[model samples]
Target: MSFPCSDQSIRPRKMQSASLPGVMEAVRCWCGDVCKVKEVTDFSDWLGMKFFMCANYESDPPESISTYVRPPSPPPLCMYYRWIDTEMPDWAVTEIRERGRRAWASLDLEERREKAEAEEKAEQKK
Candidate 1:
């Protein structure tokens, strides 16, 4: 599916609702912040695939106050990267670095809390 947006860079597409193994439920950064989902428009090979990237991925560093001063360096990347359109085997754990693993653990706790709340609400209605 396509969305009506002024930005010509992004081309959106419909994705399946079902969760895929090895695919994150919610894309997140190594710093435990959520990542943004982006669509590829320029790369012909990557077109139609949904990718996750750090929220600050494309941001530029702030400008210097003085003409002679150099701008401060950009913040370090969280290294949160993933492809939402593909699935991988469970053994793919080996591919995740320590930071990614920590982020995933945090994500797991969040998911568990959400599930428990949903179940509790369901039980209340019965």
Candidate 2:
């Protein structure tokens, strides 16, 4: 409907809610560790659904929020299929790289274990 906060001066008609059934869902950002699921009523421009984003961005909004544009009613921004597509922090990126390296090391250890198992099997056959 016509939200008082929306730029109603331009469009006199109340904007219809998009067709998608929107819902509250957990969202995580690159800069923060907490993943919070807020209600649509919590936002002003929320038509129905929208993508998750850092609300603290430079753009000043009438309402205080921590995410980007909320979606209209019809096409709900299905958060279940969404991901934390953000610019990762340098430390977090490094941490992920380290974890990947550790994973590779674990794989190498498994290879060695397999080789030892093969050697033992051959010895038993001899």
Highest lDDT against the true fold, candidate:
1
| Residue-level lDDT tens digits of model 1 in 1-126 | 222232324433332223333535665566677767764443243444566656655532244456468556655555445666553323333334554788999999999999999999999999
Clashes of each: 1, 11
**Which candidate leads the pack in TM-score?**
1
Stretches of candidate 1 off by over 4 Å are 1-24, 59-72, 87-126
Candidate 2 per-residue C-alpha lDDT over 53-91 given as tens digits, one digit per residue, 9 for 90 to 100: 233322223455534565433432221212122243355
lDDT of each: 0.53, 0.39
RMSD of 1: 17.1
List the lowest-lDDT window of 10 residues for candidate 2. Answer: 76-85
Q: Estimate candidate 1's alpha-carbon lDDT, on a 0 to 1 scale.
A: 0.53
lDDT of 1 at 72: 64
